[model samples]
Target chain A: MDVVVDNLGVFGRGLLVSIQISAATFVLAGLLGVLLTVCRISPVLPLRLAATGYVELVRSLPLLVLLTLFVFGLPEIGLIGPLLWTAVAAMSLYWATFFSETLRAGVRGVPLGQIEAARAIGCTFGQVLTQVVLPQAVRTSIQPLASLLIAVILNSSLAAAVGVTQELTGQTQLLDQRYAQPLVTFGAAAACYVALAFVIGRSAGILDRRLAVQR
Target chain B: MTVTTEAPVQRRPLTVRLGSIGQQDAALFDVPGPQAQRRIAIATALSSLALLALVALAVRQFAINGQLEWDKWQLFTQWPVLRYLAIGLLATLQVTVVSGALALPLGALLALARLSRSPLLNRPAALYIEVLRAIPLLLLIYAFLLGLPTTGLRIPLFWQLIIPIVLTNSAVLAEIFRSAVKALPQGQTEAALAVGMGYWQTMRLVVLPQAIRMAAPALVSQVIRLLKDSTLGYVVSYLELLYSAKVLGEFNHTIIQSYVVVAVVFVIANLTLAAVAGQVERRFVGRAHRT
Candidate 1:
C-alpha cells in the first residue's frame, strides 16, 4: 500500500500511455477498418481475396507474439527505432482487424437504395462514398466501435511484453518488485483498470443515447 | 395486425451503386472482357514487376548480410525447447476450447434468463451485461489471476486466468444472443403459448432454434475472441504459446524469428477455427433458407 501510494505518479504515467496508445489506435484503425471492409466486398476478386486474407491473418495470432515481433524484429531490419512505435504499430494492427469487421457490418447495414440515390443525384464516386456511405456507416457503428476501442484499451496491456514501460499491467509488476507484495499492488492495479473500464462503458452508453435521439 | 389480401407492390429495379458493387468491384483487377489477351498481358507485366522488386530486395539483404538467414528458420523445427513450445501451444488450445465450451452454455443461460418474464432475473442479467461490457478483459484477468489467489481460493495457475475470461466473454455473448432472440417477432412465442405450451417447452423447442440460427456469425466471432484471449494467460504467468515465445526471445537472442513463428502459428490456428465457423454458419443458413 505504501509503495503504490508513493509511486502513484509513476503508475499514472503508465495509465496515460495506455490511453494514448488506445486513442490513436482507435482513430487510425477505424479509418483503416472501413477501407478493409470495403475491400472485403470489393467487386475485384483479387481485392476481396486479399482483404479476407489480411483479416484472417490478423485475427489468428496472439497480440503478444505480434508485439514481440515488432520490438525485436523491426529494429533489427531498421524499420523501427523507438520502443513506443513498436507498441503503437502492434496495437494498431490488432485493433484494425477488429475495427475493420465492425466497420464492415456498418457498411453492410447501409441501404442499397440510399447509395443508388446518391449516385443518381450525379455525385462523384468519392463524394458518394464520403457523403453518403461513410456517414451512415459511422452512425450505425458507434456501439460496435466503442466495444472495439475498449478492447484496444485492454490489449494495450500486452505491449508490456515489448518493453513499453509503465503500462497498468507492467506497473503492477514494478510495484510488486519494489514492494514485494503482489497481492496489494496487483489488486490496486486491477481496481484502477476496472474503474477506467466502467467509465468507458458509461460514455459509450451516453453516445448510444445521443445517436438514438439524433435519429 | 390485419391480414392483407392485396398483392405486394413491385418497384422497378434501381441502378447498382459502386459501394454495393463497384462498376468493377472494390479495386477491380478482373478483365474477363473481349480484350482478354491485352488484360492478361498487363497482369503478367504487373506480376513480373512485383517479382523483380521482391528479388531485388532479397538480393540487397543477402549482399549486406552475406546470407538470406533463411537457414535460421530451423530453430522452429530443431530446438530443445521445441517440445516445450508444442506443449505450451497445446495448452493454449485446451484453454481456448474449454473456455469456449463453458462460455456457450452459460451465455445461453444468461441470454435465456434475460428473456425471462420475471424482472428479478431480467434486471440482474441486464446489469451483468452492462458491467462486463464496459470493463476490459485484462481487468477481469487480473481479478481472477491475482485477486482470486489473494482470497485464498487457491485455483490452479491454468484455471486462474481462464475463469475470469469465461465469465466476461459469456456475459458479452449473452448480450449478443439475447439481442438476437429478442429481435424476433413476438408472435412466435405467442403462438406457442396460445397452443398451451409451457414457457420452458417453448424456449426449448421454439425460441432457441431460431435465435441460434440468427446468432451464427456472432457465435463464430466470439469463438475467435476466445482463441485470442487464451494468449492473455501469458500475463498471468501461465505457459501459453505467447509466453513460450517470450521465453525464447529472452533466452536465444533470436526474438524476431521466435515471435514470427508464434505469429504464424496463431494465424494458422485462427484460420482453422474460422474455417470451421464458416462451415457451420453456411450449414445453418442453408437449412434456415430451406425451411
Candidate 2:
C-alpha cells in the first residue's frame, strides 16, 4: 500500500499513455478498417483474394508473435527501427485486419437496394460509399466499434512486453521487482485498468445516447 | 442495358461508361476485344505485382533468416504421442464446449433479467455487463489466476480458466440476445397472451424459440468469439493452441512462420464456425417454413 502511494504518480502517468495509445490506434484502425473492408468487398477478384488472404494472415497470427517480430525481427532485415513506432505499426496492422472485417460486415448489413438507389441518382462509387454506405455502416457499427475500441485499450497492455514504458502492466512488473509487491502492485495496476475500462464503458454509454437521439 | 437501338451519337451501355469495358465487349460471354482486354490485362498484372510483394516478403524472411529448420510442425502429432495429442486438442475443445454451454443459458437468463421491470435487478445486470464488456479477457484472465484457486474448486485447470471467460461472454451474448428479443414486434407476445397464455408458457412456446432463432447469427458469432477468447487461456497457464504455437515460435526463432501457421489454423477454425452457422440457419429456416 505504501509503495503504491509513493509510485502512484508513475502509475497514473502510465495509465495516461495507455489511454493515449489506445485512442490513437482506435482512430488509425477504424479508418484503415473501413478502407480494408472496401477492399475486401471490391469488385476485383484480386482485391477479394488479397483481402481474404490479408484477413486470414493477420487473424491467424498470434499477436505476441506479431509484437515480437515488429520489435526484434524488423530491424534484422532493415525494414524498420525503434520500439514505439514498431509497436504502433504492429498494433495498427493487427487491428486493421480485424476492424476491416468488422466494418465489412457492417457495410454488408446495409440494404443493397439503398446503395443501388444512390448509384441510380448519379452517385459515383466514392459518393455512394461516403454518403450512403458509410453513414449507414457507421450508425450500425457504433456498438461493435465501441467494443473494438475497448479491445484496443486492453491490447495496449501487450505493448508492455516490448518496453513501451511502464504502462499498467509494465508498471506492475517494475513495481513488483522494486518492492516485490506482486499482489498489491499488480492489484493496483489492475485497478487502474479497471478505471480505464470504465471510461470506455461510459463513453460507449454516451455514444448510445447520442445515436439514440440521432435515430 | 435494355438495348433500344435508337440513333445515338455514342451508343454505349451506361455501365460501359462506368469503365466496365471488359463486360461491354465480351460478346456478353466470350473473347473480349483488344482494348478492353488490355485494360483487364493491366489490372491483372497490377494484382500479380501486389501479391508478389507478400509472397516475396515471406520467402525473403525465410531465406534471409535461414530459420526454416527451426519449425517442428510435426511435433504436434509425432512427439505428443496419441494420448497427449488428444489431450491437447480435447483440452481446447472441451473448454469451448463447456463455456459455450454455460454461456447460452446464462446469457439467456441475463437477457431476461435485464428486461425485467425491477430496477434493482436491471441496473446491476447492466453494470456487470458493461464492466465485463470493457475489460479485456486478458486482464480478467490474469485476475482469475489469483482469483479462482481460492474457491478450492476441485475442477481441472480448464474450468479454472473457463469461469471468468464464461462470465465475460455471458455478458456479451446476453446483451445480443436481449436486443434480438426486443426487436420482435410487441404484437407477437400480445397475440400469444390474447390466446390466454402466461408469460413463461408463452415465452417457452412462442417467444424464446423465436428470439433465439432471430439472434442466431449474433449468438454464433459470440461462439466464434469464445473460440478466439479461449486462446487467452495461455495467460493463466492453460496451454491452449496459441500457447503451444508461441512455444514453437520462441524455440524455432522463425516467429513469422509460426504465426502464419497458427493463423491458418484459426482461419480454418472460424470458417468451420461459419459453416456450422450457415447449416444451422438453413435448418432453422426450413423448420420455420414447415411450421
Candidate 3:
C-alpha cells in the first residue's frame, strides 16, 4: 500500500497516457474503419478489391511488426513522425481492418427491407447509407465495437515497446527497473488495466441496454 | 412488460441485403454509370500509383541502407543466425503447444464448474473468466515474470511463461466451452438425464463431446491467439522469435531486415493455421448441413 501511494505519480501518469492513446486510436481507427468498410462494400470493384487487399495484408501481420515498421521503417521514406503518432498510426491501421469487418457485420444485420424502403422513398445511395443504413449498423455493432476498443486498450501496451514511456506498461517497466518490485508494481499496473476493462464493459453494456429499451 | 413487448420484434426475419451468396462483392453500392466508371478508373489509377511509389521508396531505402545486399540475407542461410531463429521458433512452439495442452483440461473443468448447479462453483468460475479476460496477457506475463521471484517461488523460467498463458487462456477457453454447452439444445441434457445417467456421466459422454466439436473452430482460433501471445515472451527476455529477431538485427545492424524476416515467418505460420481452421470449419459445417 505504501509502495502504491509513493508510486502514484508514476502509475497515474502511465494510466493517463494509456487512456489518451486509447481514445485517440479509437476515434481515428473508427473513422478509417468506416471509410474502409464503405470502400470494401461499395459497388466499385477496384475500390472493394483495394480495400480487401489492404485489410488482408495488414491484418495478417502482428501489431508488433507494424509497430516496428512504424518506428524504424517510416523514417526511411521521409514519413518521419513522433513515436506517439507513429504508434497511434500503426494501431489505427491494424485496428481499422477489424473495425471495418465488424461494421460490415452490423451492416449485414440491417434488414434488407429497410434499405429497399429507403430507396423506394427516393433516397439516393448516399442518403440511404447515411440516414437509414449507418444508424442501424452502428447500433447493432456496438457490442463488437466495444470489444474492439477494449482490444485497442490492450494493444496500446505494445506502444511501450517503441519508447512510449508515458503509458501504463511503460511506467511499469520503469518502476520495475528502478525498484525491482515487479510483483508490487506490475500487480498495481495490471489492476489498472483490469479496472479499465471493467469500465469499458459496463459502459458498453449500459449503452446496449439503453438501445434495447429504445427499440 | 418489456419482455412481452420485445417478443414480437424478435421473431422478424433478419436477412438483410448481405452481399450475394457466392463470390461476395463486399462492396455495398450498385452498378456505376459511365461517368462514375471514369471517376473510379481515375481513382484506381491514382491509388495504384501511390502504392507503387510507397513500395519503390521502401526498396530504395533498403538499397541505401545496404540491407538489400545478397550477402546480408546469407545470414538467414548461415549456421548461427539460422540456428538462432530455428531455436527461437522451437521455443515459441514449445510454449504454445505445452500451454495449450494444459489449458484444455483445466478449461473444461472450469466450464463444467460454471455450468454446474452449485452456486459456489459457478460464482468463482464467473469471476475468474471476467477478471482474466479483462487483464491484458502482457500484464499477466509481467506480473509472473517479475513478481513471483520476489515471493521466493524460484521456479524455472519455462514454467514462468507457461503458467500465465495457461491461466489466461484457460479462462477464455472456459467461456468458449460454456457458450458451446449453452448452445447445445437443453433437451439434449434433459434427454440424457431421462436415461438415468449421472450429471458427470452425462457431461462426459453426451454434452462435452458435442460441445467440444461445436467449439473446435473457436478453440483453434484461441490457439492461434496463444501463438501470437507467445511473442510477448520476448519482454521477459525469453529467446522467442521476436526477441531472436531483435538479437540478429543488433548483430547484423539490419534491424528492419531482421524484423521483416521474423514478421514473414509469423505471418506464414499464423496464416497456415487460419487456412487449416477454415478448411476444417467448412468441412464440418458442410457435414452438419447435409445431415
Candidate 4:
C-alpha cells in the first residue's frame, strides 16, 4: 500500500498512457473497421474475399505475437517508428477485425424488410447504406463496440512486453522491481484497470439506453 | 388468399449463434442492377490492383533487407530445430490443458454462486467475476510472478503461468455458463420445482446438463482464447512456443523467420481448434433437432 502511495505519479502517468493508447486505437480501429465492414458487404467479389481473409488471419493470431512481430520484425522491412505508435498500429490493426465483425453482426440485426423497403423506394446502394443500414447498425453495435474498447485497453498492457513501459502494467513492473512489493504494486495496477473498465461500462450503458431504437 | 398457418420457431445452430463473419452480407444489400454490377466490377479491379501493389511493395522490402534469402529460413528444415519448436508447442498445450481443466469447473461453481438466491454467495461471486474479467491476464500473471515471492512463497514457472490463466479464464467461463443457464426456458426450472426437487438437485439434474450442452460451443471457443493467453508464458520465462522461438531465433540469427514460423503454427493450431468447435456446435444442433 505504501508502495502505491509513494508511486502515485508513476501510476497516474501509466493510467494516462493506457487511456491514450486505448482512445487512439479505438478511433483508428473504428475507422478501419467501418471500411472493412463496407468492403465485406460490397458487391465486389475480390474486395469481399480480401476483407474476409484479412479478418480471418488477424483473428487467428494472438495480440502478443503481433506485438512482438511489429516491435522486432518491422525494422527489417524499414518501417520503424516510435514504440508507442508501433504498439498503437498493431492494436488498431488487430482490433479492427473484431470491430468489423461486430458491425457486421449489427448490420445483420437490421431487419431484412427494412433494407428491402429502402431498395424498393429506389434508393441507390450508397444511399441505402448511408441512410438506412449504417444508422441502425451503429445503434445496435454500441454495446459490442464498448466491449471492444475495454478489450483495447486491457490489451494495451501488452505494449509493456514490447518495451512500452509507460503503460499501467509496465509501470507496475518497474515499481515492483524497485520496491520489491509485488502484491501492493500489482494490486494497485489491477484496481486502476477495474476502475477504468467500470467507468467505460457505465458510460456505454447510458449511451446504449439513450440511442436504442424502441420497437 | 389461402388460409395461413403459424410458422414454427426456428432455432439457429450454435455455429450461427457464435457469429461467424461474412455470412450475413447478402442480407445487407440487394442484388445489383446493371449499373451497380458495372461499378462493382470496376471497384473489384481497382481493389485487386491495390492489393497486388501492396504485396509487391512488401516483397520488395523483404528482398532489399535480405529477409527473402533462403538461408534465413533454412534452419526450419532441420530435424533438430523442428523438434525443439514441437517440444515448446507441447509445453504450451500442457499449460493450456492444466489451466483449462481447473477453470471450467471453478467457473461452473462461480456461475452457480452468482445465481444463488443468497446475497452472501451471489454478491461476492458477482464481484469476483467482474473484477477478474476487468483485469488483464498479463497483470494477473505478473502478480504471480512478482508478488508471490514477497510473501515468501515460491512456485514453479508452470504454476506462475497456469494460476493467472485459470483465474482470468474462469471468470469469463462463468459468464458463458450463466448466460447459457439463463437462456434455458423458464419452464425447465418450474417443472423441476413442481416435481418437488430441491434447488440444488434441480440445478444439478436438470439445468446443468442442458446448459453445458448449450455452452459447449462457446466453451470450445474459449479454449482458443486460453491457448492464446498461454503465450504470455514468454513473460514468465516459461519454455512455451514463443519463448522457444526467441531462443532458437537467437541461436540461428533468424529472428523474423522464427517468429513468423511460430505465428503460422499458432494460426494453424487455432484454426483447427475453431473447426473442432464448429463440429461440436453442429453435433449439438443436430441432436437438438432430433429431439
Residue-wise C-alpha lDDT for candidate 2, range B1-291, written one tens digit per residue: 598878767678864554442221111122346875777678767877888898898778756755444434444345543344345446666678889999888888888888776899788888777666665565565555554444443556777678878998999998998888899899999999999998778878888888888898888877876776666656655767656655666775545555555555666777777788889888987897798
In the predicted model 4, the residue pairs found to clash are none
What is the CAPRI rating of model 4's predicted complex? medium
- Which residue pairs in model 3 clash with each other? A41-B26, A41-B27, A41-B28, A42-B27, A42-B28
How many backbone collisions does model 3 have? 5
Per-model RMSD to reference: 8.8, 7.5, 9.5, 6.3
lDDT of each: 0.75, 0.70, 0.82, 0.89
| DockQ of candidate 3, scored on C-alphas against the true complex (2 decimals) | 0.37
CAPRI rating of model 3:
acceptable
Over the stretch B1-291, how does candidate 3's per-residue lDDT look in tens digits?
445544454443432322222125323345678998898778778766876788798788778766688887777888878888989888988888899999988998998888999999999998888888777777777778777877788877778878988999999999999999999999998999999999999999999878988998898888877777787776777788888887788777767778888888888877887898899889987886677
Residue runs of model 1 more than 4 Å from their true location after superposition: A1-12, A34-52, A78-80, A173-215, B1-67, B79-84, B117-120, B288-291
Query: Could you tell me the TM-score of chain B in model 3?
Result: 0.83
Measured on C-alpha atoms, candidate 3 has an lDDT of 0.82
List the candidate numbers ranked by TM-score, top first: 4, 3, 1, 2
Q: Is the docking of candidate 1 incorrect, acceptable, medium or high quality?
A: acceptable
| Lowest lDDT block of 10, candidate 1 chain A | A41-50
Candidate maximizing TM-score: 4
Clashing pairs in 1: A43-B25, A43-B26
Candidate 2 lDDT for residue B189? 92
Candidate 1 true-interface contact recovery: 0.37
At residue B112, give the lDDT of candidate 3.
87
